[model samples]
Structures are given as C-alpha cells and as structure tokens.
Target: MDKSWIDWADWCSKPYRAKLEDFLNFAYVNRDPSSRIYCPCRKCENRKFFEKVIVRQHLHGNGFWKKYKIWDKHGESRDGADSLHRDEMFMGSDDYMEEDMVKVLNGWTDKSFKDLLDICNESMPEGVNLPNSYYQAQKLTEDLGFTYNTVDACPNSCMLFRNEDINLDQCLICKASRWKEDGCSLVSDLGPGKRKAAKQARYFPLKPRLQRLFMSSKIATLMRWHAEKRTDDGVFRHPADSLAWKDFDKKHPSFSGDIRNVRLGLASDGFNPFRTMNIVHSTWPVILVPYNLPPMMLMKQPFIYLSVLIDGPKGPGDKIDVYLQPLIEELKELWDEGIETFDASSNQMFQMHAALLWTINDFPAYANLSGWNTKGEYACPSCNSETASIWLPNGKKFSYGSSRRFLPYDHKYRKDPRSFNGLREYRRSPTTLSGVDLLTQLQSNGILTEYRREDLQTRQMMGLEKPEKDPLKKRKHNWKKKSIFFELPYWKDNLIRHNLDVMHIEKNVCDNVLETILGVAGKSKDNISSRRDLELMGIREQYHVKRRESGSEYFDPADFEMNNDGKDKFLIALSETRMPDGSASHIARRVRLKDRSISGLKSHDNHILLQQLIPLSIRSSLPKKVVEGLIDLGKFFKVLCSKLNCAADLEEARSRIVVTLCDLEKIFPPSFFDVMEHLPIHLVQEALIAGAVQFRWMYPIERCGE
Candidate 1:
C-alpha cells in the first residue's frame, strides 16, 4: 500500500511503471482484464473508463491523479484504509466538520431543531458541543458563500428599482409608490424614513455561480464530462451526443474549442410556494441547468442554479421578461466577453463562456417565454400558422386532428377519408420555422419592437406613452412580441430554442386515454358533446345518439369505451397491481373502488401508467384494435423517455408515432385529439435532435423547486 511512487516526477521510470502495474493488478484482481475500469491518469481523472491495458498505458503516459491515493472507485474503500489516514482525512479538516454540521441543520425543522441540538450535545464528549441554536448553526455556514440579492420590483412588474432607478420612490411609467401603503396613514405616508417595498425579487448573480462550479476539483472535472468522458458511439446518452449540440458546435467553433465552456438549459415555472390550493398565489423561480455535466449530475438539485425568484401574488404571465432582466444581462456578458474562471482540476485560469441552449416548460408557460399565444386555433408552436385545428360546435373547444397529413404520402391513411375527418388528407407535415424565419416574420408583421429597459427609457425621454395595439396586426398573426431571448446574439442559430415538456404531455395523454376508456363522468373526453360532434360530421353513425320512440336517447357504445363489466375488471387489476419501490406510488391508494376510477395520481404515477401499466391493464378489457392502439401509444412514450437512444431508433419511433396517432384518430372522436395529443408527433424528432426526454423535461425542475 506504499503510495510513494504516485508522486514520482518521472512517469517512465521502471519503479513508477511497476507500482502502476501492481495497483492495476490489485484493482482488477477478480474482474475481467478486458472490461472497462476507472482510469486514474492525470488527464482521465477517474472520470473516463478504459480497459486495464489502456488504463496502464494512460497511467504511464500521463502519470497518476496524484491526490487519488485511495482507489474507492476501483474496489478499494475507506474502511480498509489505515485508521490514522482516515482520521487525518476527516477529523483533521475543520471545513469538512462545518459542512457536515450544516447538512444536519438543513434537515431539521423549527420544531425539531432544539431537540436535535440537545441530542448532539449529549452524544458528544465533555468540552465538545454543537451550535446551541439554529441561527448560530446558520452563521457557522456563512463562510460557504451562498447568498441572494433582494431588488425592489414595481408592484405592477413595470420595472426593477435598480441602477438608475435605485433612488426613485415611485415608478416612472405608472406613477405608483415604491413602498407599501400604510393601513392607518391618511396621505399615503406613515412618517417613516424607510419602509418595505411593495414587491421584491431575489436575484442570484450568474457569474459567481458559474465560476464556483470550477472551484472544486471533483465538480470541475464533472463540468467537462459531456465533452471528455461521454461515449462517442453515436448513441444519445447525453445532450452532447445530440444533433443540436453538434450543430451548435459546428456553427460556433470558438465556443466549442474549450470543453469547459458552459451550456445551460433554462426552466421557469410558477408554483404555489405556500403548498395550498385554497390560497391562489404563485412564485416563479428561474433555474439554469448546466448541460456540460453528465446526465446524472446535470438534472440534480445542487447543480441547478436558481438565477431569479420572481415574487408573485399573481403569476407573472408575459411580464416575466421584466424579472429576467438581471439574468439576461449576465447571459449577454457571458456570451460576448467571457468571464475568467479558475479550473481546480487543471490548475489554470481560462475564460468561460455560456449559452442558453433552450428553455423547459409546460404549454401555458411556453406562451409566456416565447411571446406566442399557445391557445386558440394557432396553438401548436411547431405547426405555427399551419396548425391543423377545427372548432367543435358542441364540444366548445379546439380539436386538433388532420394527423394523417403527418403520415407517409404512400401510406393508406392518406387516401382513407372514411377513417379520418370526412375528407382525404393530401397535405404534408408543416415546415418547422428557423429562428431567423420567425424573426423575419415578427419584423415584417411589426411585432419585433424593442420592449426592454433601454426602450422604456427612450420612450420616457421622448414624452411618449405605450402605443395602442394594432387590431389588424393582432388578427393577422399569433406573434405577441419578439421574445427577449432573441436579443442574445446566438439565439437565432440554435435549432431547438424551447423544449416541449414530456412530463406534462405524457400525463395529459394518459388522462385523456384513461378517462375516455373508463367513461369517468365529467372527466371523460367521450361525452354527449363528443357524440354530437361525430353526428354533425356525418361519420361514425353507429356512435351517434339515437332518439328512441319513448324519447330517451340511445347511444351505441364505442369500441374504445369499456363496458361496466370491463371497467370493473380494469379497476380491479389496477388496484391489485404492485410496483417496485420508488418506481411509482401505491396503485391501490389511487384506485377509488366506489368511484370505479383512479384518482389522485401524481406526475410520476401517470408516467408509469402511460408507459407500462395502462398497456398491461387494457389488454384483457378493451377490444383488440383499441388495445393495440393504446399499447402502441404506450410504447412510443416508453421509447421517448429512455435515457439512451440512437438515431435509427428515434427515426423509426417518429414514423411509428404518426401511424399510432392516425389509428387513435380512427378510434376516438375528433374532440379527443387536443394539442397535447398532437404534440407527440414532434417529440421523437426532438428526441433525435435534443437527445433523451429526461434532460429536457420539467420533472427534475419541478422536484427541485418543491
């Protein structure tokens, strides 16, 4: 166990080679010699995997990662290490002790904080003691350098009281007072020198947070994982393997030159911070996930940076762009003139630049970020002006069909009018608009006007007020305003600017399919209105409501809908089902036997149901064709949600999903195909370009906020 050779200057020396061979032999003793092992070379840093022979060669060429004396990754453990060495590593470090203390204090609640402290004090010997109070423990961890800056915001979200406006008592645009109005004061004044701001936002500066990623040698190495250790076998395990990432690299070689240059995905969603449905309030937190790290670390809470917390009693809809000012300014600086960051792993300083690859959000929030109206006839963002939608008079909502157009031209579904809407589909899939194309459209349509801080100041200086909306322009296009993200120099060139969240999409699809099949009253998509829509279309006559001689309506049962007996069997099967721990929640708890339906399922539960459970549960109850169609839909999601995918597989999935939707169209009423159902047609293509759905989805972001 003598580690003296690890520090040897001459790696080629016979002594060093002999020691390395000994270490390798010891590490790979019972394991296969040809199998991959963690290479401990200075260049590899135990991050890259290599065969034993290659690892030996790397060690000889680059020397060992000198600090990695204990080979924990290579089967060695701290328990087997010399006791004295273990004590020196842990007990001797004051910073380590303080970090451990902070972790313990963080888990303790206000009611249990004192109880935990008393227990710690009793356990420790004579003179040793833990912090006496929660505040004392908090102060102990103050040196950790975690903090947020509070900036007073206009109550109307008109502007932030920062820089030039820091001294202003009232908003220049609205003439509203900055401070909260006193309840007892008569003249909007409480005779106070300082008062609480009407609203405040927490801004966590991006530069320092990005720089801190490299301060630790362990995390510093991980930050380069996408470029360094990722397998280049054409499989999409990480975002780096995706076409969009490679395309970005090809277009911007300078940014890609350094592997350490950060690639970030922004996710912002409003949540009820109070965790109560009765209280209608929302707080939106903008989080940035650094994609430079490998899949496992990138989506984790600790690595996700909270750039801004937009305070809200009412969610900032389109006005969220105002709250994103600080973040955007920092991002602009990061992209233009990079910041100098010290990488602990390399022991050198280098300029680190970052670009926001895309944003992850649900459909409603997508409208707020992209400056597009995600409702009405032009709801589908990808489809844009070409969105295929029809208003169902009875359903009173937009039903997105015409899925046969997305099918192959030679496919029978294209010519089969009877199976789909009353007309045959010859139209091809809609063309996806490039960022440049969108920008040009916005400019031509007169919707690309500047709306940032400088524009506001310019308007104020000219003694001009905000202009009235152009009725013609509004009627002509869905463009609300050019997105604030378009201001970034590279935003236009990026392929996927904002991702469609797979989490919510999957849940919605599952709910639609499940409720309709189960015939859950009120929630089911196959209601009386849906039947009326079918009757108006003059298709599926068998399903239309018939007026009996007695005047009671007689509706024929659809193939997709389960009968009372079938419903009982389906519910019973789901209730009796057991899942692996942590895979999903208890199915029985969600199953309401009295109601004969499932309820209170969380997002993950729905994910599981969509991918695996529903397909299994429906096989015995539903008709063969209906069962096959639902199973195909389930398979599509299962493949889409995978952590690893290849281009060929995704391409096949793309074709398969189109047919699946067509088949679903034939089975369900037109009213069942909402925008959520249409979204799946594009998900496979996105997975091919953006890699696995897990990284782009809101599941991790939602869990982190909670």
Candidate 2:
C-alpha cells in the first residue's frame, strides 16, 4: 500500500472508526490490517491493492462521500461502489414501487405528485427512504415515454403565449395581462412592470407521441394493420374501406396514395371541469386520435394524444379559431411540407404526412369551427335547407318544432307548400362549395369578413330569416365569414371538414326527451293537450289534488282506469321518489304518467330512462303509434350500445332510426322535433354517410368526464 493511503487510513480511523468498520464490512474486507486485496472500484480499477486505508480513501473521497452518506442514512449495508448490490437492501422494493406506480399511472389526476409522495412516505417505515423525489419521479416517468410539454398561455385565453406572442406585453385580442400583475402566481417579487408567467397550458405534441407509438412493436404493427392486415373482400374492416372514405380518396388521390400515412380525427368540447353548474367555467381540450389503430384501442385515453388545452371562464366559442392558431399551423406543415420521422419498429426514417380526416364536435362547436351557424334558420348543416322553429312559452327560446323534410321534399307531413307553416322546407343547396370557393367568397378583402353575400343570399329564401333575424345575432350578426377550417391545406371540400359527432347529438336529444317525458316543460309529456289524449287511452290517475277542509279529493283528473302491469312499473319509476338529501320520500301519491312532475334528473338517469325504463312505463298508456315510436327509439339506442361489426351495420341502424322517428311525426307533439331532437336524426344520417364507427362516438369522452 502507498504511504498516502496509510496516512488516510490513520486520519479516517481517528474520527470515523464506526463508519470505517461499516465500510470494511460493505467491501467484504479481511480483519488483518496488512492483508492486501485488489481494489475493484472505478477509481483504483483493480491496479491498486486494497488496504484498510485505500478502502477508506475510496469510500470517503469527495466524489463518493455524498452517496456514501445516502447509504448510511438509509441503513444501507453496501458502499457507493456496490450500488448494483444495493438491491439486496431494497428487498421487495420492486413490488412496492410497482404498486405505487400503478396508482400514479391510473389515478394521476386524482392526487398531486406531492400528495402521492406524502402518502407513500406515510406508508413506509421510519428511516426507510423513497426511491425518488416527486420531481425525480416525474423525470423518470418522462424517460419512460409518458410526460407533458407545458407552455405558457395568454391569461385572457386568446392564444398560447408562445412564439411571437411570448414577448408580447398583453394579448392583442383581449388585451389581458400576460403575467400575474398582482404577483399572486409568481414565486419571486415583481417590481413595477416586471412579470412572471401567469397562466400555463399543457400541450402534448403529436410527433414524439406518434413516434412513441411506433416504438412499441405491438402498436407499430397495429398502426400498419389498417392497410396491411385488413381484408378487402367488400367488408368494412376499416374506415378507409368504407365508401365515403373511398370516395374522398378518389376525389383527392394524392392524399390517399400513401396508405402508411396517418389519418387523425380532431375532437374538442367546452366542459365545466369544476363540476358546478352555477359556476360557468369551461375548459376545452383538443384531442387527436390516430385512426390507424384498431377500433378497440383507438379511443383509449392513454392512446389519444392531447394536442392543446384552451382554458376558459367562458368557452372560446367562435373565437376558438384564435386559440387553434398553433395547432392549425403545425397541421398545415404536417400536411404540406411533411416531417422527418423515424419508425422504431421498421428501423427507418421517412417523411411522414398526417392528415386531419375530420373534426368531431357538437353543433355549437361545429358552428365555431366551420363558420356555419348551427342555430341558423337553415340549421341542418348537411343540407343547408330551411328549418322550422316554434317559440316555447316556458323555454323562452325558439326550438325547431317541426319534422325536418329530407332533401327530396317528398313528405306526406307537409300541410303547407308556399306558406311552409307546419312543414319544414327541404331546399338542399344545389351543391356544397369547395373550401377554395368558400374562402374566395368569404375573404373578399384578404381578411375574413363578418358575413358572406352568398350565405346571406341562401338565408334570404327563408321567411323567418329577416335582415334583422340573421342567426349570427349572438355576434351581432358579425359571424366571421372565414374560419380556421378554410385555411386547412388538405380540406378543399367544406362538406367533409367537420364530422357530425353522434355522442353530443344523442346527449342533447336525450336531454330534450327527458325534459319532455318528466313534465319539466309545458311542451313536454305533462302538457294539457297530451294529458287529455292520455286520459282517453284508459290511463287516467289522480293529480292536482286540491284538498278541501274535509280532506276530500276535488278537481281530480283520474276519470278512467289504469292497466295493471304498465301502471305498476310506471308508478314505481315516478310515483314516489326519495328527496335529494335521501333522508325521506316524497309521500307515495297516486299520479298519472302524463301528469308526473319530476325534475333534476342527471345524465345517467336520462340514460337509464331511455335505455330501460321509458319503453316499459309509457307503452301501454300512449297511442299505439306513439308507443311504438318511443319503443323503437329506445331499442335503437340499446342496439347502438351493443356490439357492432362494420360500417354497414351503422348505416342500417341509422336508416331504421330515421324511419322510426319520421313515422312518429304525427304521433308525437310538435315540440318533440325541437332543433335539439331534429339535429340528432340528421347527424346520424350524416355519420352513416361519413362511415363513422363506434370508437368515434362522443359517449366515451362524456363517460370519461364523469
């Protein structure tokens, strides 16, 4: 041993004999002080013989002491050099860590990282250290191909505070502060004009995430499955195999030429994440789903990439175009210029082209993105034909209160031709204009105007559409003539840009159905006219019981007898219900189905009513045709919720629903065809034409929200 090593041993033994003994044990050293063992540590590298002194220097070296302290702190037996062997000290740690990781992965949003760490720490024994800090845990997760890219956003929610806007003092549109002016969100002191980032939005990019998908051999194989694995024997194995997708490909051959290229569907909706209806805060998250994967895995939350988040107190509404600027620019680059991307499965680099196949959103979001007012006189986006709406007494809003005529205008329900009073007109436009023509007509001065003459001319034909009554009245009739959609390099056709989401349409229609059924509105099931009709069907029960001083029934409506089985089920669903607090029941009162008064039903309650209860309770009481229509509607939704194999199945289901709803026009009250209800029928028809599969349904997202 060297003389310096001997001196170092003498120095360590004077102050740290206990530590030296621990180190000697950790290095598996012999007891004899003179005995020579080869030093296998990285510093000495086996060239130098290990004496007690040399081992002490190596363990106590400035570079090694910090980790040695950690070893000591954790009651670790091995020295820093033997870290790989530290696994022995951490016996059962892998299993424990894996269990913790599952909680992090599954319910990430449920608890903050610090809270998760605190909980984990609480479970561990005293002196037992965790594997990583919260930030280190996040870094480790990122290394595992899951993480977020956060970017600062404008406080006003006008745009993402990045690129050119990064240096901007205030938002150009809303003129809101770019930083926390009051120093509330800042960590450091802000003096006068100085500021810190006030608001931030998490953005997960498509490129790296898509590359990560390719990294997994299983997913990479599935990504190419749409083109290679699918059978092309006149069956809908994929959306590309459907007629609508094929037609689009035929129209734009260049886009469809590369079968390996990815196709994506964009969906966004403003939802109150706070979960309180009274507080109107909406958060719009834009999700991009790769349709290249199989149906079963396509819409999974983990698989779907979040492209952007539009923070909101109020939803961006039509101004959503402003916030979508970054995404649109990136999409344009992906489409026109393409990006150099590597496929880990194939082990090759290629120029990747991604196409935005279609946007899926509700009517309001559709109007915002597509620049067509969904609440216009011609509310039907597919046809752009005249629509009939009636002013509701209770709602205080005009609802499309008549059955929409199909494009051909051949309908027995049309009671008026020139007047178009009871009959909704079906004047489908001669043709849908290309995006180029639309842009030319809209942006006459190189900037999007509030309204287009062509659109106004079409609206002129509708009697309800006066100069003052243009539906863009919400924007004071200043509807942006051009939308961000017009700028999409790939979409030359406007008709196909926005897809009608079946989910939102169904929910809205279902809500209306529930309101109508529960007597929540005057135009609904409990209406005087409908009650009279129900009473005629031998379905009368007592209601509006005005108790006299003698407690005798006065002004009783139940003049007819009720059927046993139907009345029993109907009464069970509606007769007496627990109060909101669940403390007591509203006394079991005998009430007619038509005279039922109930409110505050949740979305799932509506689902239960539509899926199982409605048909069972209402069938025996209403007219035969009305009963049949309601049963058919319920059956259709249940069928949709079942296993569907192909696009043909969707088309068949849509056709049956349309026919069933059309047949009920005379049977149901006019309010049943309110715009909310009318919209879904057309949306389903459009989805059938577009060849949407079950994976693209909005129900999944809404269910996720819940």
The RMSD of every model to the true structure, in order and in angstroms, is 10.2, 12.5
| Clashing residue pairs for model 2 | none
Query: Could you tell me how far off, in angstroms, the CA of residue 562 lies in candidate 1 after the best superposition?
Result: 1.0
Q: Ten residues in a row with the worst lDDT in model 2?
A: 72-81
Q: Whose TM-score is greatest here? A: 1
- Candidate 1 minimal-lDDT segment of 10 residues: 83-92
The lDDT, on a scale of 0 to 1, for candidate 1 is 0.83
Error of 2 at 166 (Å): 1.7
Q: What lDDT does model 2 reach?
A: 0.57
Candidate 1 per-residue lDDT, tens place, 174-193, comes to 67788887676423365555
Model 1's TM-score against the true structure:
0.81
**Candidate 2, 1-706: lDDT as tens digits:** 1113322434345445554555566544322345444443446644455565675667555212322233322223322233423332343354445755766456654346557666776786432344445565555445545566666666645566677656666655446667665535443245545656666666666666766676555777788877777767665445656566666667767766766568888888888866778898888888888888876676787676778776666676665665666677778877787777666566666677777877777678888777776764556555443454455454344545344344335654443432223334554323444456656645553334222333333444443243366444444222434676656765765336777765556655666664554435453443554433333322323332345799863543221223444445555665544436653234234235554543554444555556666677675555566567778887776655554345566667666766676665544444356566665455444445555446556656655544
Best lDDT among the predictions, by candidate number: 1
Q: For every model in order, what is the number of clashing pairs? A: 0, 0
